[model samples]
Target: MKTVLKYLPALTLAAGLALSAIPAMAQQPAAKAGAAPAQPKSSPAAIAAAKEILSMKNASAMYANAVPGMVEKTKIALIQQNLNYQKDLNEVAQVVAQQLNGRQNEITEGMAQVYASEFTEQELKDLVAFYKSPLGQKLITAEPKAIGLSMAFMNSWAQNFTETVMGAFRAEMRKRGKEI
Candidate 1:
């Protein structure tokens, strides 16, 4: 489980980049999690275009901490379950982080492969052209904040609606001569 968790970020980075529908390069070995699901055979031109697209999107930010974060999260989880090892785990965290340094490319490469597989050479080139345009630059700059604000809005809406639903339930229950 620990080993699997260690490599999960690579998979997550790949998936996350795809879901972000914007970004960089990333890939890993099969031992990472499992055999990567087969990707469509992309032409060299397509792959190169995809790589350029990812670079322009600054996809590295999406995965730069993945390896270190994995190490830290694992260390914390271990320390919690083995209280006696807390000190040792904390001491080893830096060593672990160092050892795993540079592995983020694994994620970025896989992400690039995904983009390459999903888009044809022409499409990837078109995307690169778009990203190079002023509007594309604006999107790259603004999308993350937009996503953050959208999430915040959704959370607030859910919280308020949850309270409204609870109030409605309570009112219905009261008419039935019960208090909740």
Candidate 2:
């Protein structure tokens, strides 16, 4: 238990760094204009905002927020506390996985909406071309794994950290004859 606790922070940080690195793949490059310099289809500001909102960071944060409720739900379904910990953990993992999958869908859908509003058909074609390149495909593959690993690491870290902190606090309260 202590060994796991000791390495939790390192694992969490590594997972976070890995996840943070995954999303650069899908980022659209600067739009190139053809001979006519096609009147810059989308406002640069709107494009920037859409990119920011649809970014991996934003998606990961949303996933992170959804995980605790999942964990709690698992805990509440106790059959036998000791025997069920692993089972509960597995269930929570599934929940997080599903949430990440949904988030990726959301990001894709949001991008489609933005493209519809911001770009003409030709400009959308140009954007799709860039995303279909090798770099774009790599990003698409990596982002989900990054998200999953990061969430798993953080969930473990949070559970352990909460246990540690709450254990100490409860001990202190017990010493003071206070009900926790």
Candidate 3:
């Protein structure tokens, strides 16, 4: 559990990215019988377009904006997992922050693969153009704040949901006159 907690931030980011890809993958049309399987890497044109889209979205900057929140959340988890390591908390957080930033290129590369596979080169170009537009830029700027708010809301909802579920479980146990 402690080891899991230590890697929680990376896992969370990875899971979030992976989950976001699901809808994109689902939206793709089914290939005809005997069609070639999807390749692991995209074609050069698609890769170029994906990079442009990423640039237009300022993907790295957005992740950097999100880092503070990630750091704070990780700090809390570390404290919970290692209460006796108060003196090393700051150093640990600094190291985590550095590691997260260092991995941004790898994350962006994975994202580019997802985009390239899910979208044609033309589609990626269109997306890049849209992101370069004012409205798309507005969304890009707003996304980090939206993500933070969404996380907070989900956390609160989960707490309430857990309490509700546990209450129901206790009621059922009492009804059965079961002692624990």
Candidate 4:
């Protein structure tokens, strides 16, 4: 518990940094004034696929599960402590969300630049509409969970892969009478 508490701030900071680094669609520059926004040429199937992929139920559930662990690790004692804990967590979450949203905007803007030549204005409008729907809203709201899960999965995989590669390297070095 104490160890978890000791690392909480570091972990939170790392998470914030990681979230802020993601590329989003909104970060791209707009076209010349009076020029139309470029949109992706997407079919109904494609739109449906995007909507399905962005489901927030799973993300919300995962967030609900993980938040309690974080709160517990923080070790708040009373109503005031709990309130403070909530406030701090909410503040940090908002910051991370903004960073991630900025990144998303950047990516979208870049995509717009690329697909501008390929897609029509209406297609872009449709894509934006889909993104602004209730489902889209849910996905945006639940982004933190998705980010957290992805980070955890990647970190675990990288750790295991590094250990395996390093272990093999050390073993080979030892066999060759070299310092590992």
Candidate 5:
């Protein structure tokens, strides 16, 4: 009986550790099953048409332009701490610009594949024609402003939704004798 009592605490600790590990173990099969195979490369002609459409749309420039603002926002705390932040930020921006430029081809190629797969060759040609027209050109120019407005609206909506949902969650947790 004395020996059994001595080992009982160790057995309980081992059981607690095993129970803590169950969530991690449960995730392994889902990860293996959910991975998809790599897609084959797009054809050269399709790649060319996609490139033309992407250039007309100026997609890469839009993506690259967004990075600097995002990076600056992320570094706000560091900027507050240092007086030489302008110089540091400029250098970091250059490096980030270089990296974006370096990856531009890969990004463009991926986008081209999406275009190629989704649209027929004739459709892509028609799109190129449209983009070359005055209306399409206007759309290209106006898109950034439209996107900015859309994002602002969505952000306001998300904040309100998150607050409402979290308030309910806290209430439920409190009812269960747990506060989060």
Candidate 6:
């Protein structure tokens, strides 16, 4: 469960990227430390188009549980810091979750901002048009399953490789008169 929790943000980001032309957009090299490029200024039209594309992909649904999960994580951390406040922390978590309900749209909006900044208004318009087409619609339906299968395969491969690496480590350590 803890592992699953830790990977939730990655999964959410992956899901969003999987739904967009992120691979192409990611071609540029990352910036050096403290030298990140500024986000391009997005026009309202560009933002709107980005929002439409995101809506077609149902992006907000991916983060539907985020608010509640964050509240719970914070509550647990607070409880850990002051065990005597566990009950109050739990109550506060519920209140915070309630207050933040439906705020998952914030994630959707932020993603739209990223898309809008990365692509021109015309490009975003083109994306919306593409999503409206039959082939694009088919991709929208198929991509999630493809991503699921890919993740499963990668997990299986990594698990099998883990033992191989562990054995190699042990062998190398034994040769050095040290056991690991």
> What is the Å distance of residue 159 in model 2 from its true position?
1.2
lDDT (10s digit) by residue, model 4, range 1-180: 344444443344345334433443346675789987666555655444333322322222223333444444443443346675676766665565544443333333332344333434455456557657998667555654555556667768899999999999999999999977
Q: Is candidate 2 or candidate 4 better by lDDT?
A: 2
Every model's TM-score: 0.74, 0.33, 0.57, 0.35, 0.48, 0.77
lDDT of 3 by residue, 1-180 (tens): 344444444444445457656777788778789998575667888888887777665556546546656787879888899899866997888887877766556667877887788777787788778878998778666754555556667778999999999889988998999753
Residue-level lDDT of model 5, residues 40-127, one tens digit each, is: 5566777788789777665565455445555666566566777577678767766875665555457667767866655556766777
Ranked candidates (lDDT, high to low): 6, 1, 3, 5, 2, 4
**Candidate 3 or 2, higher TM-score:** 3
Q: Pick the candidate with the highest lDDT.
A: 6
lDDT of 3: 0.71
Runs in model 1 deviating more than 4 A are: 1-38
Backbone collision tally, model 5? 0
How far residue 45's Cα lies from its native spot in candidate 6, in Å, is 1.2
lDDT of 2 by residue, 1-180 (tens): 455444444344345445433543235455556643233446554555445434522343443434455555655555346564777666766676566544444544555454444444555455445556787656555655555565668789999999999999999999999969
Encode model 6's per-residue lDDT on 74-153: one tens digit a residue: 88889999999888888888889999898877888898898887788998899899989999899777766665666767
Most accurate candidate by TM-score: 6
Lowest summed lDDT across 10 adjacent residues in model 5 is found at 8-17
Error of 5 at 106 (Å): 3.4
Q: Superposing all C-alpha atoms, what RMSD in Å does each candidate have to the true structure? A: 8.3, 15.0, 8.4, 13.4, 19.4, 3.7
lDDT of 2: 0.53
lDDT of each: 0.74, 0.53, 0.71, 0.50, 0.64, 0.80
- Model 4 misplaced regions, further than 4 Å: 1-118
Steric clashes per prediction:
10, 0, 0, 16, 0, 0
Q: What is the RMSD, in Å, between candidate 2 and the native fold over all Cα?
A: 15.0
Q: What lDDT score is found at residue 46 in candidate 5?
A: 70
